[model samples]
Target: MKDKTNEISMKKKIKNKAFSLMAKKGLKDISMREIAEACGVTKPVLYYYFKDKEDLCYSLIVEKSVVSNENLKKFAASGASFEEILVFIFSEYMQDISHKDVFPFVIHVSSYLLSNPDLGKRFEVVKEQNFAVISGILEKEYKKGTITKKGKEMALQLIFANLAHLILNSCEHAIKFSPSYPKDMARAILKAIDYREK
Candidate 1:
């Protein structure tokens, strides 16, 4: 039992350390040696846990994305109304982007991967899986006549477009050293949801 607990704890520590370093240093600048130093371990140990930097980064991104998707799905599963679902998603996204230091890096890496044919495929797969979670909720809302789109394709596009715009705006503000205005932006997103609002 103690051994299992120690193993779990050590794994968490390594993940946390790697994520911190990735956030501060960016993917291109981060090295296994740096992650090891941050974790108070050595490069060989990191390699033992992860094959390479790309492997570590891919794992981290997928892990975080899946976890976020799970939480969003749980919120959607709560028998909430469409408006409530929209608000919940916006609030949760704002909270995640603002608080998690690694998210900015994750977004950056995703964008980069999406442009390269080799890595783009993997990121795209991960993206589709994550998007399906939100799209599924949107599909339910659309079926209930709560949203404009009646199909998953349209719903997915709109959701992704809105979310991508909001995230990019927030990132730009952060880069400028300006205070985050997620609530204001989130409200704008809420207002833009349907033809009636337009």
Candidate 2:
């Protein structure tokens, strides 16, 4: 039992340091040795916990990403109206980014993935799992003729990406935007996805 606890603690240390290293230097630029050093562990110990660099990347995506959770799945699968769902999602996202840790962690993982396309394939399963919940909602609307023939990606991109961009832009570039931007973004996504404005 103590061994298991120590293993978990060491893994957290490795993940935390690896995240910082990846955020500082691009993902490919950082090596296992550097991560091991940051954790004050030997190369063999790091290898025992993670198979390789690819395994570490998978760990970061699968184990470290906070985006995948039962709450998010439940929210997406809720019977709320499309507009309500959109507003709720964007508003929650806005609140999430306001936290000191969550937003930056998301940005780090995202930026790393953006640059390293090859590593992204490992994350595809998790992405598909998340998409399934929202896709069901979008498909229901599509079948009801409430939305155009477009699939779920359009709505996902418009809501998540646009809202995230607004927050990130304000934080990094001092780009001026109204505080109501999240609400407006939800509305814009509604329009883009052809959901009738209410």
Candidate 3:
């Protein structure tokens, strides 16, 4: 019994290592042998966990997309107003940058994979779920007369589009710009979302 559990745990560790490597070098340059080495294992051990490179990439994509959508949903469920919700979402990104280098690549990889129909479908589903959560929050705020907009679905899309742009922009200059990049991006995103803020 314990042996099976240990094997499963070891497999998970290898899979996570592969995802981390993919985030660093990207899918185009990643190899099974490299992934195994990164995980301190042999190429055959990596193959024991995954069929091939494509299988590893797909698994990572599905895991990441699902986890991200879940987090977004939980954040949107907070009783915060539209502006507060926007701030919370942006602030979460600000907080994650230091601890997890792969954080920024989450959206970047999803956008890059938009060209692949299979991956695009998964991305679209996760995106729709995220937007639905945001739209629900916006609808609540609108009902409370905080947001003067009736078209919440459009508003949610715009907010997410702005977020994606902010992430992309910050990532482009994050290394050279140092801490200023994410800070500036957060401010810009907040300003875009809270146009009526006094």
Candidate 4:
């Protein structure tokens, strides 16, 4: 039991350090040795857990994305109104990101992922599965006519696209926009989906 706990703790430590390093150094440019040092572990220790750098990255992506998806599921089940849910998701997700710089780092990693089909597909599958969870909720709302006339496609597109934009704007773009932008955007997104204000 202690060993398992240590394993989980070590993985989390490595992930946090690697993510911070990647955010600053760019994912492709970071070396496994550097990641080891960042985690206070030897290169051989890293190798014992991760087959290679790509494998470690794949695990990171899978683990983080899964957590995001699970959070979405919990929010969906929380019985909050769609608008309330959107506000909470956007506000909380953006605020909870340990480092804003990781957004740009993610974009860099995504470009590399495309060239690696095996990892890319696994990544896509995780994304699609997560989206499906949101999609199911939207479908229910659409049937109830609680959402705007734009329907499922537009709602889904707007919700996720706006999320990406928020992250990028906050991270990559130099402009220091209003702190309220995320919540404001969230409200607007909901309004775009349904004209009737909740």
Candidate 5:
């Protein structure tokens, strides 16, 4: 039991260190040795926890995605209205981008995934699972005639594109947005999709 606990702790430490390093340096520039040294562990310790750099990177992506999907599921199950849920998700994303580590980490991971087709395909599967949860929520709105099927599809694209824009402009250009940005963006998206309240 103690060994397992220690193992979990060590793995968390290694991941956190690696995430920070990769965010700053990009995946191709970072090495397992550097991650091990950052974590104050030997190279062998990192290898014991992760088979290789790709394994560690993939694990990081999965860990974050799983937590995000779980939260989306919980929020969707909470019976919030579609507008409320959109605001909540946008707000959460805004908060995440505000963190120093998140934006760069997302960029690093995205660039890495683009270059690694196999890994990108695996990521797409995880992404689809998340989309399904959001789609389920959107389906409720569709059934009630608040949104058309085309509107539902556009809503998904608009929401994610908006988030990507926010992160990119905010991080790369150091742009700042008001506290009400999330709610404003949510309303804009709904308006763009011609959503009608039932």
Candidate 6:
């Protein structure tokens, strides 16, 4: 039991240190040796916890996405209106990206994904899982003829694009919008996609 506890502790330490380094230097720039040194561990010890840089990064992203998807599921099950749920999602995201540590790490990971499409492909499964929750809700509306196929696609794009904009501005500490920004963004997306509130 003690050995297992120590192993878990060490892995957590390694992940935290690696996240800090990667946030500042990015994935390609930092290495396992550097991550090990930052965690005050040897290269072999680091390897024992993670197979490679990509594995470590993927682990981190999966951890975050799991929690994210859970929240999405909960919101979807909350019996709220679709528009209300969309606004809530945006509001939650704004709160998330406002965190200094989280914002930089997100930016770093996003940059790495954009620059390496092949590597990015590995994350598509997780991305699709996250999107599936939203798409499921949208499909209900589509089936009811409440929204068109194009409208569903446009809604997803608008929400994600606005989220990217929020993250970028938050990273630069240039967020000048009012506290109602989330509601405003949600309204704009619904308007753009011609979504009818049911």
For model 5, what is the error of residue 168's alpha carbon versus the real structure, in angstroms, after optimal superposition?
A: 0.9
Model 5 earns a TM-score of: 0.92
Cα lDDT of model 1 overall? 0.69
Worst 10 residues of 1 by lDDT: 176-185
Clash statistics: count for each candidate: 0, 0, 0, 2, 0, 0
Which residue pairs in model 1 clash with each other? none
lDDT by residue (tens digit), candidate 4, 12-61: 89888887787778667889999999999999999988887777877887
lDDT of 1 at 94: 64
Q: Write the per-residue lDDT of candidate 6 for residues 95-167, one digit (tens) a residue.
A: 8876677777877888888999998999998889878877888887788676889999988788778878887
**lDDT tens per residue, model 3, 94-181:** 5544445455456546655765667567556656766666777776766765446744555666666756655555564554434454
- Candidate 1's residue-wise lDDT over 5-121, tens digit each? 987787779888878777777777788888888889888878878998878888877887888888878887887655556666666666666755735776657655766679767
Cα lDDT computed for each candidate against the true fold: 0.69, 0.70, 0.64, 0.76, 0.85, 0.84
Provide the RMSD of all predictions against the true structure, rounded to 1 decimal: 3.9, 3.8, 4.5, 2.5, 1.7, 2.1
Which candidate leads in TM-score?
5
TM-scores of all candidate predictions against the true structure? 0.78, 0.72, 0.66, 0.84, 0.92, 0.87
lDDT of each residue in 14-128, candidate 5, tens digit only:
8898888989998878999999999999999899999888789878878977887788778878887778889888887777777788888888889998898887897787778
lDDT of 4 at 22: 77
lDDT of 2 by residue, 1-198 (tens): 999999999998898888667756756678999989989999999999998766886787676335644665577566677777766666665665554444455566677778778777767777776567567767777777777766356886665577658558645445755667667876778777767523
Off by over 4 Å in 3: 1-8, 42-44, 75-78, 98-100, 103-115, 143-145, 148-151, 172-198
